[model samples]
Target: MTVSLDELMAALTRELKPEQFKDYCPNGLQVQGRAHIGRLVTGVTACQALIDAAIEQKADAILVHHGYFWRGEDAVLTGIKRRRIKTLMEHDVSLIAYHLPLDAHPELGNNVQLAKILGLNPGSALSRQNNHDMGLVAQLPAPMSGADFAALLAARLQREPLHIAGSEAPIRTVAWCTGAAQGYIEQAVAAGADAYISGEISEPTVHSAREHGIHYFAAGHHATERYGVQALGQLLAQRFDLQHQFIDIDNPV
Candidate 1:
């Protein structure tokens, strides 16, 4: 079975509701390719490596969370960008991206998926963007010490989070936003989260966690963001009965 590129795009835009959030990049099909898609591949980003892999896999479309033309990036197709776009065009493989929408989707979002993996029960939105929150606040099943919680993250994500412990107390309430959301620590603090987990951390995050008496964990951005696109791919494949594969091109940051 196959789905028209238009049909797939419409389904995605409806499911993720990209129009609701103001994002750094466009949230749907970024490149035109074949009109109908039978084989779909999903990945974290639209880098040259992922495109090459898609070409090798004979994919009709490559769906991803990160695509080209981010705000403030030079509009010209040059160097790596040019090579990537050219490769996709040569293969006639469509490139679809969902930035904030993929992050915030209620059932198949990055933060929600991460919460499920870490056994955190989601409670409320972490912060509002365009009147909808892009992250999640959660209640832990039981209190776990800060170090224990950090260890749990490392075990699950397979990457050691840089732990900035706020207090010796155990973590009961937590908030998390995936992929470079360290700036939302203030919101986590205000929510009374005992700990805040995000993809990347800045220098200022250290003082904020300590002064605010909340734990902060800098899990790898790539690691935290890997789930949503895969989940979306699975759903699309199941819905349309198209062949789907999630290719992981690992990144440390």
Candidate 2:
């Protein structure tokens, strides 16, 4: 079945609620394409490779977690940026993206998806200081060593996370936010998490985890985020009966 680009956007907007959160990029539709979309493609980022893949797949619209025109980025559309946009325009493929909104969606967001994959039951917002419910804290069913928890992440995420030692005790509580959210370890500490998991680890994160007495894990940014878009794609497929394909472009970082 086919749906109008605007209709698809409306469905996504109603589900994600982009206006609820302050995001770095535009949430709904980034590029205009043909009016009706029969084939929809989803991916983690709106990169050139994903665009090429979508075009090859004859996709009518592309939904993604990351899109262009990020806040504080270079305003000029030059080099690769120009090429990506030009290719989409030339092929008449719609580019729809959701950033912070996708991450925080209570049921379909990245955090919730990752928690489901890791078998971690989300309890509360990771940071109590703010109203933004981006990350989540989960008390484990049973306490396990930090090494064992890292191994579980490795098995589930298919990538060995960078583990930083902090507390000697087993990890009973973990707070996690997917995709370049290492800075939230402080919030995890404040939440009284025994360990914290995020996509990227900065230099200061090591010290923060150590000094705060919390274990830290740096799961791959791309690895941890692969599920949410796929889940969203499946939702679109089920809801609209549109042909949905999720293209995963491998990224080491």
Clashing pairs in 1: none
Instruction: Say which candidate scores most in TM-score.
Output: 1
TM-score of predicted model 1?
Answer: 0.98
What C-alpha lDDT, on a 0 to 100 scale, does residue 135 get in candidate 1? 84
Q: Residue-wise lDDT of candidate 2 within 1-253, one digit each (tens)?
A: 9988878888888998888776777888999999999999999999999999999999999999989999999989899999999999999999999888888888888999999999999989985322468899999999999999999999998899999989899999999999999989888988889999999989999999898888999998999898899999999999889899999999887
Predictions in order: lDDT = 0.92, 0.91
* Clashing pairs in model 2, backbone N/Cα/C closer than 3 A: none
Q: After superposition, how far is residue 242 of candidate 2 from its true place, in Å?
A: 0.9
